[model samples]
Target: MVQEGLERLMDRIVLAYSGGLDTSVAIPWLAEKYGAEIVTVTMDLGQGKELDDARERALALGAVRAHVLDLRNEFARDFVLPALQAGAVYEQRYPLATALGRPLIARHLVEIARLENASVVAHGCGTEKGNDAIRIDLAVRALNPDLEVLEPLGVWDVTKQEKVAFAKKRGIPVPAGADSPYTTDVNLWGRSIEYGVLDDPWLEPPDDVYVLTRAPKDAPDLPAYVEIEFERGVPVAINGVTLSLVELISSLETIAGVHGVGRIDLLENRLGDTKSREIYEAPAGVLLHAAHNELQKYVTPRDLARLASEVGVRYADLVYNGDWYSHTREAMDALVAKVQERVTGAIRLKLFKGDHRVVGRTSPFGLYDQDRIAQSADTRPSLELRP
Candidate 1:
């Protein structure tokens, strides 16, 4: 049975497809229910060879066309770098990796929709109970109101198991099941794990939830030292060797991961109106943010540092809440860019078991006054009755 209003409202529908269980079902479901031709877009933000398979799957699952765009550089330079510059962390924990990526994906969805002359954009965002639906929907509305956004699973009464069943019944291929009991999303910046037993805050996340790191105990016996170079707050090199944005981050991930540098567990406050236990593996992002923060302390004034911290939190909130296209976010970006002008330098970091700290920092623009603070002419071993 055709859905009542969809027939008139949508002709061709462009979908932000992931080739996951929900989105695999969406290709057929949208066609059957809305009689709309489906165009699928999958972004490659350094998720590796899976995208080639995903594109193939999207077409096999009944998409009229599938586009797989490599957006790694743009994602890093435009979205990820700005987050790093502001030291953006949601709730002071999450590096906003997943949050930051959604807006860029949403923008691409609109672009595909326009090129395809589609009247509607759709996502397989599973439930209204998650932040992704709100983020993707708000971005679509903000960027292109002419295109109606659809969440097929939000209205459909299908459970996860049923969706899997539907895929099997419909002859759509599904990835083999794993014993690992977590839902995961990975990109160049980090990996985020949620769902399954992770919903319980009291239970410690199983070691399998982590993808980019070893357990601190299992890390190498020796500590690893890394030096990151920054130009205006964006990381550009590792140990003085220049690299592209993506390569720089990837190198840090390996160097930091060897010593167990990034692992975070939080009972995060979600935009969906609940607190959720989320685990993140952000070796590169964590190390870069730490390096950037330490370097900024050398060059940034106290008052500006305090204010930038405040701006970072607000920036995190906006990015997390799907307000990335808003004027307020643009204004905040301007402030962050100004603050980053003098944040050019290098930071040496010592990475050990589950912890890392800045061991040294240097910058031509540094505000540290070593001669006065460390070796003053009038310094004395003991002061008598100064008070």
Candidate 2:
């Protein structure tokens, strides 16, 4: 059924597809609602083999064309690394993995829309009840306000099961794991799980919700230690071996996941002025932020360090709220960049069952001077004479 005013208004639409159920259903739905030709874009941001047949799936769902982009390297170097340097952690728990990916994805949506001569851009974000839909909307408008944006689920008012039925009725194949009540978003930086049983804030997340980490009880009995080296606040090496930014993060995720080191369950404040229970697994992000902060503190002065901490919170908020392209965010990035100039060093961490702490840090710019220390044993003589 075509919506009254929207029918025929959109001649062509470019959709940001995730190869998930929501997006699979969207290809046919968008075509029906607006009588438009639909082109789907699926981005690869280190989800491994999960995206193997995304293009084929999109084409089978009646898409005029399908685009599968490999954006992992760009995602890491351009999006993830800057947030790592800025120390952008939402509410000190979330590393904003999904948040950081939204802008980059939206940017490409606009580019694809222009190439396709699309009058509108669409997304499978589903609803405005959560953060992502708004993030997509704002980012697209920011990049190109002239392009109309559409969200099918915002108006569809259907349950997940209903969506499954809708897809089946149209001969669109339901994605694996569609029957599961939980909703998940995955990227290089983290994996976020929510909805269904997770909406109950009091209920502990089931073990099935986690894929990147082991249960704390099941982790190795012996503690594992890792040495991370940072150059200008970006992690460049692991245990004395240099790696690309993407490789470094992937290596840390494996090492830290084995120790069950990065699992966060929090009651998060959504941008819609509502609170919701969210679970996130970001092993690499956790380790890197801790290690980077340790080395940063070793070299940074008190006032500058404090300022970075304050700016970091705001930076996190802006990114989470979908203001990634704002001039204010750019200004904050400049401040963070200056802070990073002195943040080069190495951090050694102890990773024990679901816990990680920085046990050692060293930097060429470190301010501490051991020989000039005024210890209890040696400092009394000079002070007593003055008194």
Per-residue lDDT over 1-387 for candidate 1, one digit per residue giving the tens place of the 0 to 100 score: 123344453579888887667788889998888778899999998764467677788888889999999999999988999888988888887898888888888899999988998878888675633688788888988998877888887768667778778888989877655223567777888888888988888898887777788899999888888899988887888988999999998898888887887898988888857788889988998998888988887898999999998998999899988899999989998999999999998999988888899999999999988778767655857757865
Which regions in candidate 2 have their CA more than 4 angstroms from the true location? 1-5, 374-387
Model 1 gets an lDDT of 0.84
Off by over 4 Å in 1: 1-9, 177-180, 377-387
lDDT of 2 at 14: 93
TM-score of each: 0.94, 0.95
lDDT, candidate 1, residue 259?
83
Question: What is the C-alpha lDDT profile of model 2 across 1-387, one tens digit per residue?
Answer: 123255565788899988888888888888887788999999999876667788888898889999999999999988898888888899999999999999999999999998998878888875633588788889989999898878787767789889889988878878789998788888899999988899888888999999999999999999999999988888889999999998998999999999999999989888867887899999999999898877888898899998988898998999999999899989988889999998888999999999999898888888987656756547756545553
| Predictions in order: lDDT | 0.84, 0.88
Give the top-scoring candidate (lDDT). 2
lDDT of 2: 0.88
Residue pairs in candidate 2 whose N, alpha carbon or C atoms collide under 3 angstroms: none
